[model samples]
Target: MQLEDMTLEELKRLRKDVEKAIETYEARQLSEARAKLEAQAKELGYSLETIAGVSKTGSAKRLPKYRHPDNPTLTWTGRGRKPKWFIDALESGYEKKYLEI
Candidate 1:
């Protein structure tokens, strides 16, 4: 533990180990706190997700950017790969604007 006895490499490695330990401790603390809160919420007839205002769905819902002309139920947020219907419309010479909701 003496600074004078430790080499530069040894000090660097020790720092890395200490940082990893701190990170692990912090993560465990956070998990424990979340579990405690969830247990309390459940006892009160509420879910942790509801109390935290977090959605079961991804972080948050993204509004649909496009809708099917014939079947309005079909929709997409233009995030990932296009859906089959959307590709079909494009292949049928329909412009992307026509799919906008």
Candidate 2:
């Protein structure tokens, strides 16, 4: 069937079918990858969660290393993205030492 010859409704239906196929394909691929990784982790004497640094509850949280200068309540663990307040303080010439808790 030629897409150029299909009506708008047929085109929409085809698009939906294509999306479903892509999703199923991606899900199968992801499951296979996870199973392979789990097997590899088991062979190395470690569970997949331990190899991935994850706990049953969740990943462990790091301690906060920096605090907002003006707000005592606002603090950051200095891990992921820097908070806006942290960035603003650095831009305004406030050294990291000044923000250390």
Candidate 3:
């Protein structure tokens, strides 16, 4: 069907189908590449994970850099999003140094 003749809904559907096809194509390509690499690594008597130094176990937990003044139990590593208590403390004029562990 001609692009000019297709209705708005049809055009939107076509766009969505195109996007999904692209994603599927890319994922299949990546899977094939990974499999080929794994096969090559196995032939060399080493797995890809070992050559890449990737561990199955998760990384160590980050220790808290800031602690709640009112409740010492509540703490934050100050890496990701700020906790509600931390936000409240900052809003109430509490400096970051005052919350340090």
Candidate 4:
């Protein structure tokens, strides 16, 4: 319909309807894009976020498995390279079983 043919109220309602249609189209487009990206990511065995260089915000902390004999605060989960405390203790005739928590 021509803008000149519509009253002020009709124009306002048309504007609102057009805005709503735009929002719906935008939402649908975003959903489709996300799905396509996810499918593309899965072909490489990764999520879209990871493939895009985004790290997970809620990465979990590792649980400690070994604690210092004298200081309970000093603990290691024994995942990566051994720390100085762990290496020193092993060098001083200490066995790995002794540090088990």
lDDT of 1 by residue, 1-101 (tens): 79889999999888866654543453345446667887999999999778777676876876566766556678888999999998987785556765664
Cα error, residue 26 of model 1, in Å, equals: 52
How well does model 3 score by local distance difference test? 0.71
Clashing pairs in 4: none
Q: Which has the higher TM-score value, candidate number 1 or candidate number 4? A: 1
Clashes of each: 0, 0, 0, 0
lDDT of 1 at 84: 98
Judged by lDDT relative to the true structure, which candidate is superior, 1 or 4? 1
Candidate 4, lDDT over the whole model: 0.68
Pairs that collide in candidate 1 are: none
Tens digits of per-residue lDDT for model 3 on 1-101?
89999999999989866654543453345446667888999999998777777654558465556767666678797888999998997786566655665
Candidate 3: segments with Cα more than 4 A from true spot: 1-58
**Root-mean-square deviation of every model:** 17.8, 16.5, 16.6, 24.3
> Considering summed lDDT, which 10 consecutive residues are worst modelled in model 2?
22-31
RMSD of 1: 17.8
| lDDT scores in order | 0.71, 0.71, 0.71, 0.68
Q: Once model 4 is optimally superposed onto the true structure by TM-score, how far is the C-alpha of residue 47 displaced, in angstroms?
A: 26
Residues 1-101, candidate 4: write the lDDT tens digits.
78999999999888866654543453345446667888999998998778877665667555466655545677797888888887886785556766655
Model 2 local distance difference test score: 0.71
Model 2: colliding residue pairs: none
